[model samples]
Target: MVGVLAAAVAVLAVVTGLNLVLLFAVIRKLRTTEARLGTAPVATLPKQGSEIGSFLIAAEDDSMISDASIGDGMTVACVMPGCAPCKTQIAAFRERPRSAPEKTVFFVFGGQGEPETEELVTSLAGLGQVAVTQTAGAVGVALDDVTSFPTLLRTEGGRIAAVGRTWEDIGAVAVATVR
Candidate 1:
């Protein structure tokens, strides 16, 4: 029994050592990748105050939604099926007081046959018009900076007022009231 216990301890120590070595290797690789990446974004978003890219999204009611149709200052939220923070972004829009339902738009980016697409579109019901599409839609082609899922942008006169990955960056309370 004592010999068996000793063997178990030795085995556990070996396993522990292997785990540590693997962990160190992972950490080293991560550091190297981070250094290589620096601060470059995969894609750039449209600059603030620039004319936003043109996009046409069909609402559930069959009405067409485009950058031109958003009344006055428009608040646009871009989210995807796999994005985790996207849920929080939706919650923020739902829980917080919004300015105008007509002026709000949520882009649910997903290809056909994506299971989570329905859930996202359904959750966005009544909050604003929901547009489920693949490949970032026309906005990506125009803005190029919408690579980050859950990006929130406020635009007026076909130009972007403010945009960011978080609500605070664009101002939750402040942005709610028209600029």
Candidate 2:
């Protein structure tokens, strides 16, 4: 009986050691992925009054969203189709005042072939223009140095004026820019 008890203890120890090793491996992998995502430093983005760099606007036609097109100012929202926060942000953006539709633009991450992409475009069309592009090299993401979803930027006179992560931030910028 004593020998059997010792064997069980040895098996438990071995299993525990293996679990620890696997856990550490998973933690290391997660850290690597996080580092690669290039999430921007907290609240330090779109430096106020900085000129935005040029980036291609994904569209069916040969058009681009540039500072030239938005002469006065515009509100740009960055969204990922499958992201929960993005969905919430979209809904909030859609509910913005009626006068804001013309001044808004949505930069949707990922290609336009998916059904969700189509739905997103149709929904946002009512609010403003939609530009679909992959996460890499996307104009809004690149210009704003965004590392997370639902980043909104307000521009005035071809320069960034405000940056935010929530609908309230967007509203505040909108009101501020108008004045």
Candidate 3:
């Protein structure tokens, strides 16, 4: 009985050591990711009447933002794969009114070479235009300094009229900003 007890204690110790190593590894990875994301303070986001810089649409043929198929005004949605909140945001976008598609542009960041990215692009293609970019920072620089995921921007007459985090907010802004 004593020998069996000793064996069980040894096994428990080994398992505990393994878990500790894994926990430390995860912590290190999290810190590294945080550092890479930077600590820049979030700026006061653009509101109505803010003119935004143009961003390119990384299409099969590569087109400028000005040449997009949008009408009257445009809605730019920033998204990234592997983000849970972004999935919810996508669902909200999908539930938007049918007329919303024509004015919508989905900027897919970190989607290059991922199978899930391809699937998302394919799915959103029917709803609106999709631009698969390498990084969110690049898109932000082009679209009035956006730095976060799931950002929705509504533009009218080539200027930002509203910014939101959900589809409801965007729809409300669209209604109020009619030219």
Candidate 4:
């Protein structure tokens, strides 16, 4: 009876060890699979990059401008509303060469709800900058890998030059770019 009890304890210890080993193997496999999928478990915003494509967006003026219609020689700054930094950048942008005929920075407002989005437009308009309407679909296309709000994309010479989630001294950056 004593020998049987000792053998039973040894078997239980081995089973526990095997279970731990299996758990580690399964975890390692899941990590490897995630790596292959080109996506992290956590969401990350996209970094500054070039234009993936040009597409037209609707606006309050009842007009439309397709991405292809944008002149290659011009630099377009597509902006969204309700972004405090965006408002400051827009204010500073108006004073920069970006407003010059050659640069042509276009404001594009995109938000989740119509009322909130309209409020953004009103706020920007009050600041004296004309903004176009960016539908939810267009916003999705414009922002690639953007996980949060307040997105600013700079397109120069027909390609995306830089993009950021915030302004962080954007006036200096804008001035430096056009000058």
Candidate 5:
């Protein structure tokens, strides 16, 4: 019985170490991929339809939502930090005109560390007027399932008109759908 217990403990330790190594490998791979596949800012907004609506965003500082309603002719750009794709998307969104009837909202999705989050918000503030919200718990995670990072969802008149993987694709789809 003593021998069996000792063997079990040794095996467990080996498995744990292996798991840690695998996790590190996976993380490194993801980072490399992101670095290699850098995206450029897109010109002009994507196509969208007449289904704009209100989308609730949990604010980080305040209890109320920052930006929820897009109205009928407005556009909303949602962004997550630490995602290379998201960073590129943000740059594109930043270039857009404030009076251009499109609204961009920045949310802190699961990525990077707290310091990175602060930097992202600060950088976005420099871009132009935008709504920054902080989501709590699994709600943000759940929202991510529906619209993952580097994703752009276009809502017109309170309904989802188009959604895409990259900001350019989504923006194009949204712009087209809106008109």
Candidate 6:
């Protein structure tokens, strides 16, 4: 009986040791897989260093906004109504100015006649030029990566210097202004 107990303990120890070894092997494989994928996240935001395509849009206030609108150090924030995160993102932007008001352009996505769309556009006017669109439509077709709401980015020389959901990720690169 004593021999049997000792053998059982030894078997369990070996099994545990083998499990640890396999765990380490799996972790190593996952790390390699991540590296193989180039560390590009599955986010909808455009990849940093990629150039944004040109566009000419009509702001809700009848202003003509173009690619030049975001020239140099402008920050572009795309948000949508009914998305809690979008509201939070904008609220944060309003509370803490990350870039110059003139350098920040907001694209609000929603149905053409939706009341919430108008409200969103109105609220963002204090920030800068605000555009209301029936959908991601043109912007989506142009920036393919801008399919998600609450995307914040700064472009420099037409290339995306930084892109993220929060200002902290892009704040430093944009034209600085306090509110």
Q: Per-residue lDDT of 8-91 in model 4, one digit per residue for the tens?
A: 999999999999999999999999998898674553444545564545665454555555545443444455656666567666
Model 6 bad stretches (over 4 Å): 1-43, 172-179
Number of backbone collisions per candidate:
3, 0, 0, 5, 24, 0
Error of 3 at 116 (Å): 3.3
- Candidate 1: Cα lDDT at 169: 63
What are the lDDT scores of the predictions, listed in order?
0.74, 0.69, 0.67, 0.54, 0.53, 0.78
Predicted candidate 1 versus true structure: per-residue lDDT over 53-132, tens digit per residue: 67777876578887677545677888888788989877877777454677678777787556788877888888877777
Better of 3 and 6 by lDDT: 6
Give one digit per residue, the lDDT tens place, for model 3 in 38-122.
7765635546566666555665235545433433467778777776877887775555432355567787776577898877677
Cα deviation in Å at residue 31, candidate 1?
16
Query: What C-alpha lDDT, on a 0 to 100 scale, does residue 160 get in candidate 1?
Result: 76
Q: In terms of lDDT, which candidate is strongest?
A: 6
Which residues of candidate 1, in runs, are more than 4 Å off?
1-44, 174-179
Flag regions of model 5 displaced more than 4 Å: 1-63, 66-68, 96-102, 110-113, 126-144, 171-179
CA RMSD of all predictions: 9.0, 7.7, 9.4, 8.2, 10.4, 10.3
**What would the C-alpha RMSD of candidate 4 be, to one decimal place?**
8.2
Worst 10 residues of 2 by lDDT: 170-179
RMSD of 1: 9.0
What lDDT does candidate 4 reach at residue 83? 62
Q: Whose TM-score is higher: candidate 4's or candidate 6's?
A: 6
lDDT score, candidate 6, position 42: 62
Comparing 2 and 5 by lDDT, which wins?
A: 2
Q: What is candidate 5's lDDT per residue for 4-104, written digit by digit as tens? A: 99999999999999999999999999889877876643433333443332345444433344224444434445566667877876666555433243244
Model 5 poorest ten-residue lDDT run: 170-179
